[model samples]
Target: MIACNFSFHYTSFKCEKNFGVFLAVITIDLTSISVTSAVISMAGKVMKKESLSIEGKQGEQVSLLIQNQIKKLLSLFENEPIQIKAVGVSVPGICYSKTGLVWAPNIPGWDNYPLLQDISYLLRGKNIRIKIDNNRTCCILGEHWQGAAKETKNAVYLAVGSGIGAGILIDGKILHGFNDAVGAIGWFAVDRTYKDAYSEKGCLESLASGKGIITRVKESLNIIDDYSGYFKDIKIQNLVIGDVFDAYKQKDPIAQKIIRESVELWGITAANIISAFNPEILIFGGGVFGPGIFFIDEIKSEAKKWAQPLSIDKVKFSPSQLGNNAGLFGAGHLALGRF
Candidate 1:
């Protein structure tokens, strides 16, 4: 048997015989409802893997897609020597731990969705346990388990995709407050003056997330009289993040101003999280961070403007090494360890 050594949350799995119990872990990362199922060996190898995409679906249709995905994955691995044991899902919004309900704004018709109940019903009598968590928490767990935060007990994962959220790790434990809503930093009051719009996703996220970035560009295009350079050719409806960043490289004034403002907001938000959690490292991930990675240094520099002086210097800020896979790995670890 191959010797396997790794840490699962707080527990360490270290032994040669541990390989005999290789478990199939299904990670349902529902940013847009995608499924990734991997059979992980005790030796830390991903023995088998499969993925499915269910874009453009919503509500009960999405639920049915997930059930089919699980059934397909299980059937595919039916002949394998190891048995599937547990399933862990990373949801986009708040996942009520006790109620097993979900609320993701990005996925329509999911207000107070009974996700856990639906999944459980589909897998009835399978003898497999299921666990659920917010995607932010899963991102940090994945980083802690196999990515950037490997040796750190305290860490924060700031995910800026279509929206913003955070996953905090304090003393090696993921912080899940009442209702698992600890990391809903998108609603954080980052601005002094409040607009009715701020109430939707908070001041910081409205100005800094991918959706925010597009909104800013649209707002700029609408108000600016000088329709020259990159802004001259782009249509509001057809605009993408790549268009704005591409313009930023060529020194477009609109892109520069928007990016600069977003950098400061990211910095301020980073400071807020650091002051609140006092984490040793802040790992940046999510789709927005794919392009925003360029601003990490500037964000840290800006954080010094408002962050608690004592804690700011002690923290290190970096981009996530695991990229899109952070939540998947985290969900797998949650299945293997917590379930």
Candidate 2:
């Protein structure tokens, strides 16, 4: 019993005896927190959509959720007579299109999971085609298709959430490196002081990501014996990234210090990206950007300090207008390319 939240107009569409002639597509943005799916018309309109929370669920369990969403989306069109033509899935991590194997470290038991195979089996005997891609790739595609970066030839989407990653577009195409592992910018070295902690998550992400910020605050709290600030009343274990930003607004010294360092790291990361790609625009997105959007000016100023002089001036910085919908809309755009 899935609730169908539809915001589509199909009055112009005529339904005859052969209602199956009506064509539509499906798009899904599969992330660590939730799974969202939408029915997209050929004209790129989202007809109907549904989202399910899947936190703490494993890979196999998520597969079931995906199945449920698809079935529910398809059932909604029975009255409308629209036939589902294709499906495009935006995955959280590296998605190898050829093999349909997804390596999502965020999802337990998702490493090297046969996602395409699973979906194919689900849609067996149906003529519908499926395309799976990395979420970062879909982020830029979503932006290029309908969001901030429309018609832009070269652009980059810096997604700073619990972790950090990028989606690079060069000459109007998504850059997929060997093994399709491009845009893994979390491992970038933005900090000069190397630490044993930075080995797995990378220096930039360890310091700048939401998890990184929360962890840094907690670690600092543990070491500092006497510090009274916004976080003083809140237990250290209960601290989250949002608390840091809230405290920053209150002008808490500890929060200011932590966020200031993160700003520097984010700027360094942006500078490095601009210097390397020389994109037309660099869009910042992810969970952090919900409040993180406020720091765009600071990041740009920081980027100007280190980015190539020629490229820095050319690149315009923006917060993601589409937000989480970027991946969903981008997945729809990618499906449109399939034909």
What is the RMSD, in Å, between candidate 1 and the native fold over all Cα?
4.4
- Every candidate's lDDT: 0.79, 0.83
Candidate 2 C-alpha lDDT tens digits along 172-233: 77888777889999999876689998887778888899989999888888887888878889
Global Cα lDDT for candidate 1: 0.79
Model 1 pairs whose backbones collide: none
TM-score for all predictions? 0.91, 0.91
lDDT of 2: 0.83
Of candidate 2, the 10-residue stretch with the lowest lDDT total is 1-10
**Candidate 2 regions with alpha-carbon error over 4 angstroms:** 1-22
